[model samples]
Target: MSPARSDRTRRPVDLRQRSTMAGEASAAEAEVEMALDAPPDPQAAAFFDVDNTVIQGASIFHFARGLHRRKFFTTRDLASAAWKQLLFRVVGSEDPEHVAEARASALAFIKGHTVAEVEALGEEIFDEAMAARVWPGTKALAQLHLDQGQRVWLVTAAPVELASIIARRLGLTGALGTVAEHEDGVYTGRLVGEMLHGPAKAEAVLALATRESLDLSRCTAYSDSINDLPMLSLVGEAVAINPDARLRAHARDAGWRIRDYRTGRKAAWAGVRLGAAAGAVAGAAAVGAALRRKR
Candidate 1:
């Protein structure tokens, strides 16, 4: 099935608009007009964070890798993105600077590309890289919401086109994500507002809720990172799935439902093994340099 067409109206909500109640309300009404064919439950819906919550890794990182393979960017750009992905995996959260850099890089790469072109590539990339990476446990949770007649929307920091593809492929309601500004069907290489992250996520959810006439107290939200606290806090039921250290602690204190799919010992051992491998590679490089110097 083709991805849901939310990106057609996926414009970013300005944070400054929240200063006035009238402005905020108007912005909410204008921002979200998701073309979800699913009949919403009216009172409730579920919002899920994409990275590490619904998927095993960062969706945008995977998408970037796919784009790099498609000759969208250079090897150096991919290396930089890979490093950011590694940091995200190790730390289990996002850094503002890293997010900004990624946003800038993404815009630079897609400048002048038509929205249709990117969306088409996104479909292929999703099948190639994102489909297999979805967490079954989290997928089940999203399915449960669907079974209960609630709309399940993937709220992510990834581009709305990619997020919408994942949502459609997974047979969910729709998605809300970062909006890249485009004009006359081509990318302008600029953002409408800011990336859909941190507090901005909460704002998007609020706007979406207003647009869809959803009750915040009846809604549920799931996420893995502490960066999504604002979003998690906005809902009536907050679930922490494979939560980071900070989010786990906060979830415990707040009495939120915590679901960890990863085996703690196994994950720790994997990290140790990765560190050991890096050390070994460094040692080999050092030995090679010493031998060359002696020669």
Candidate 2:
């Protein structure tokens, strides 16, 4: 077998044995009792979605912005910005395929760069650009759970590489994000794992819970979109933050906690969310105004 494949196959086994075991051992002495205690039939987790559910807007948007600023995307994103405007103007539905394709196109655009460079870029994107973009209340809520000793996790459709950077920065446990397929230290412009969206997010969360020995009944989940219902349905305490109409209605009917952070533009709709405000995140301005002209 090629050395790369042999290495990749062995790395996970090694990582799991070392990393997960170390994490379990380290967290063992601390109060994991939150997952154990509670009334009979305890729910044992607090799941947070990235991209508008935890951060100010779509994590992808900010990451894309960062990449754009660094000269990653082609002229196509701008060209598509126009088409997005027109599509939303006329049809009111941003095609999912287009969304995925755009993401693939973007990832493909940056394929050959080293993971370290991407991580470095991500560091700047999170700290300098998106750090202040968190919503005032969301961070507090997440901290409360962590302080209470409950495990906090970020589950998103973002690429794991990008999501892990943000998760580590925020002191969250880890992220289960969309896996962009990699081949010999390169991106393949396609997903290697499940796209953690909608029902998929719930699936991912549940899987993590099982792996981590977490309890779902005692767990809490926060989100801003109807699309996140897959995640919200699996838990007892679902907090809706700055919810859209459909999710708002669901939150109201289900008696979910609805919190708002946006200051203005409260109407039937305010176009497709370049970002959504949920958890501790607020919308951030796009990245790369400097390189926008180049594209």
Candidate 3:
């Protein structure tokens, strides 16, 4: 096997063994009780979808502003993007066509931009603004996995650079996102493959599982929209956080856990007979990485 592939497969096995050992030695019985319905698997993972699942809105909206300041796009372009952001907030993005169009628009906009330049801008914007908008409950859950020694990864359609920033700041393992094609340190205005949405998200998680030796039946996934159904369905534990209409219906019928924090009310979980609530986690810093499409 190639050295790169060999390392990818070997590293996760090592980490999993270490995690399993750590979890077994942990004395946090209370936390374990909360997730008793689906017992913890140290070798598995807790995958979270970004955007509405973890943060208030699309990370791309803020990234657009940053790019505008740097003259990547103009005032008129920013206004249009802002309008779309408002609509996304009210009406969740579940439509495949809508997602595709957004992806195309973002790819077109960033064409020819140097990867390093865009990544640097993304870091600045995220540190300045995006950190405050993360949902406390979701952040807590991600942290719980970390405390238990399970892998935690942010799965989104945002650029890998932006996703990596959010994941690192949140103290999670890493991220999987859309890959933009670049050559000689410059973007080629094309994608490496499909945008990481819908089935693409599911494929990425499965690939990670293969490399990590993660048990899909023991893994958990959280999302807020229907577009992530394939991913949510792949895991033993599926959580719907601030779910849109479609996902809420599906979660209800499937008896999956649901948490709603959009109404200024305390977030409550539904359909699970758990001993305790997932413990509260301290707020972490958030940041806008860039204007990229998310499903």
Cα error, residue 258 of model 1, in Å, equals 0.8
User: Pairing residues by index, what is the TM-score of model 3?
Assistant: 0.70
Residue 196 Cα positional deviation in candidate 2, in Å, after optimal superposition: 2.0
In the range 1-295, model 1's lDDT, one tens digit per residue, is 3354443233223233321232232233232334446554767999998887887766766665565565555655455444543443334224444444444544554566576876786788789988998889999999998888788888876667777889889988788876767789887767666656666678788877877789999999999878789889999999999876778899999999999887663458456334422221121112112222222
Quote each prediction's TM-score. Answer: 0.74, 0.70, 0.70
Candidate 2 residue lDDT tens string, 245-271: 888999999888898776663752465
| Local accuracy by lDDT, each model | 0.66, 0.57, 0.62
Instruction: For residues 125-214, write the lDDT of model 3, one tens digit per residue.
Output: 788767987889889999988777687888876666777788878878778776667788887776555556666677778777766678
Clashing residue pairs, candidate 3? 126-287, 126-288, 130-286, 131-286
Stretches of model 3 off by over 4 angstroms after superposition: 1-42, 69-72, 79-103, 264-295
Weakest 10 consecutive residues of candidate 1 by summed lDDT: 279-288
lDDT of 3: 0.62
TM-score head-to-head 1 vs 2, winner: 1
